[model samples]
Target: MIKVYGITTCGSVKKALSFFKAKVIPYSFVDLKTTQISEETLEEWLSKQPLLRLFNTKGTKFKTLNLSKELSDEAKKEWLLKEQLLFKRPIVECEDGALLVGFDEELYLRTFSS
Candidate 1:
């Protein structure tokens, strides 16, 4: 089963979930608003994906926080830990230990299509 982490109200998260449901893919959703992801888990994801990919720079949360775009990797990671909304929407953890951040229709099709 795929593990998807993000808030439900996010448009990208909604798209990802809809795609999964449409494809009949089995996935478990972890709402970031209700659940907190640990630093260890975030680090694991960061190892698989670039920090910029996992960290959402364009989101309203980022803008609202008035964070500097030139933040160092460590600073970014610290901010991510401090705010769950700073994460890119719909981070998917595949059974093969692959991590995907955000929704891309083509990527989802190629990866999840049976």
Candidate 2:
């Protein structure tokens, strides 16, 4: 099963959910605000995706925290653990163990469409 992680109120997450629903694809949602993401899970995602891809640099959370000034990769990882909202919306953990961050309709169709 695909496991989607993000806040329910996020527009991106909503779009992802709608896409899956429209396609009749099953998925489980883990709300970041309600459920804490583990370091192990984050590490697994980072193994597949670049740290920059996982980081929501354009987000209000990043701007509010002023993370762009100067921060090492280690520091950024630490901040990600401390602030789950700093992650991009709709992080999808596929049944095939692929981790996808953010929403791209073409990518989703190519990846998950039967």
Candidate 3:
């Protein structure tokens, strides 16, 4: 089963959920606001996706923190743990163990259409 992690208010998350529904793909949504993501899960996702890819530098959260300046990988990791909203919406962990950071129709089709 695919596991989707993001907040409910995010448009990207909604789009991802809609795409899954339209394709009849089985998925479980994990709302970040309600259920906190564990460090273990963060480590697992980081293993598959680069720390840069997982980090959302353009989001409001990042803007609020003003993290655009050069920062070490450890700093970024700490920020990610401190602000989950700084993560790109709808991080999808596919049944095949593929980690996708955002919603791209073509990529989704290619990954899940089998």
lDDT of 2 by residue, 1-114 (tens): 999999988888999999999999999999898788789988999999998899888888999987773678898899989999999888999999899999999999999978
Candidate 2 C-alpha error for residue 35, in Å: 1.3
Q: Point out the higher-scoring one by TM-score: 1 or 3.
A: 1
TM-scores of the candidates are 0.97, 0.95, 0.93
lDDT (CA) per prediction: 0.93, 0.90, 0.88
Off by over 4 Å in 3: none
**What range of 10 consecutive residues in model 3 has the weakest lDDT sum?**
62-71
CA shift of 49, model 1, Å? 0.1
Residue-pair clashes per prediction, in order, are: 0, 0, 0
Q: Supply the global lDDT for candidate 3.
A: 0.88
> What is candidate 1's lDDT per residue for 7-39, written digit by digit as tens?
989999999999989988999999998888899
Worst 10 residues of 1 by lDDT: 105-114
What is every candidate's alpha-carbon RMSD to the true fold?
0.8, 1.0, 1.2
Instruction: List ranges where model 2 is wrong by over 4 Å.
Output: none
